[model samples]
Target: MKISIITVCYNSDATLEKTILSVGGQTYKNIEHIIVDGLSSDNTVKIIQKHQDKIAHWISEPDKGLYDAMNKGIEMATGDIVGILNSDDTFFSKAVLSEIALFHTKNTIDASVGNIIQHKADGKVVRAYSSKYWKPEKLKIGFMPPHPSIFFRRTLFNTLGFYELGFIIGADYELITRFFLKANISWKYSGITTTAMLVGGLSSSGSSSYQLITTEIQKALTMNGLYFSPFKIKMRFAWKIIGFLKK
Candidate 1:
């Protein structure tokens, strides 16, 4: 299976190289790396160009935001499977892509999800996240998979829809909720860690970001005819604590 891994960045020179190199180091050779940059003013584009040979396609231009650039990468992707890797994240090991390929070759799945470990900029592991508790019916109860560790068939976008643009942080959440709860797409789950990310990302920290997440989750669930309750936000944190403890 040809998997297209997309990385989107903006002025992320310090952290982008590790992400690019992680994709380049994948043991699965059928992989294609597509990078979309938001006209980075620093050395990000130069670093991208340095490793351009390993990249299947890349472009640097002004974009609306992270999701917008992701949409652009989706448009450029030609592989059978599409996965987004954040600029600040990397596949956990060189074998990750190969493992994904093996899984797809054996199972007829529309999507696959794994796990992620989050850390601080200082490289201290903060917490680990997983989708083991996720079920389509649990969408109303504040359960969802880690976005960076999930891979979807390219056609899944056509069948369901692309990430909605207006959401500041919950677009990935909205997309997966729509896929599992509304569109009824089946997925395979792997216990292996696909990516290691730094914590305090858009949906992970800050009071403002949390507020935006709550509002967007509400909008996403309600608009899709699923139940939404602000009260469940605390339960979400409790579930996260369990994830941390399990790690």
Candidate 2:
């Protein structure tokens, strides 16, 4: 099956090239790469043009934010399966796409979820997140499949609709929980380390980022018809701490 890999960025010149190369170097040739830039002032556009042949479709213009640009990529995609690999992230290896394709053929998966390695500046993994532990009930406690590592059937978006534009930073947390619990979608974990994300991005940087994300996770859970006490969110935090220790 053809897969559409979308990369959304804004002034991401430093890491965008590697992200492009990761997709272009994939072993699977049927994949399409769609890039959506938010009117970057830097040389990001020039870099994209430099590798224009590898890109199937791209746009550089004004947009809302990360999630908004992602939504635009979703709208432009024309493949059987859709996956997002942010400008700051890359596929773990050239075989990543081939593995995802195999997961779809061998399993009844509407969405293929994988793992992500969030690394520090020196390339040491800070936390390794795998979808093997994710469950529908975990949504209430703030667990989600790593956003960049999951691939959805393009038709899933047609049925579930786009990301909520109202949320600027934390909409993805909501989208993940909504897909698993409220919509009752079919999904499975490939257990493959699909993407490697660097440290100090929107959700990974700063001291208060975790608090802000947890708040948004609670917000998404509430909006998706699953409300839990403050204790439930705390339990989620506890789980994450255990995961961090194990890693």
- Every candidate's lDDT: 0.86, 0.86
RMSD of 1: 1.9
lDDT of 2: 0.86
Off by over 4 Å in 1: 239-247
Question: Per-residue lDDT of 74-170 in model 2, one digit per residue for the tens?
Answer: 9999998999998878898899999998888888778878899998757788888788877878777767788888898888888888888877568
Taking the tens digit of each residue's C-alpha lDDT, what string does model 1 give over 102-203?
887887888888898998888898878777766767667567788888889899887788889978888888898888788888787877689999786777
Q: RMSDs, each prediction?
A: 1.9, 1.7
TM-scores for all predictions:
0.94, 0.94
lDDT of 1 at 18: 94
Clash count for candidate 2 is 0
Residue 102 of candidate 1: its Cα lDDT?
85
User: What's the CA error at residue 135 for candidate 2, in Å?
Assistant: 0.9
Query: 138, model 1: CA deviation in Å?
Result: 2.2
Residue 29 of model 2 has an lDDT of 92
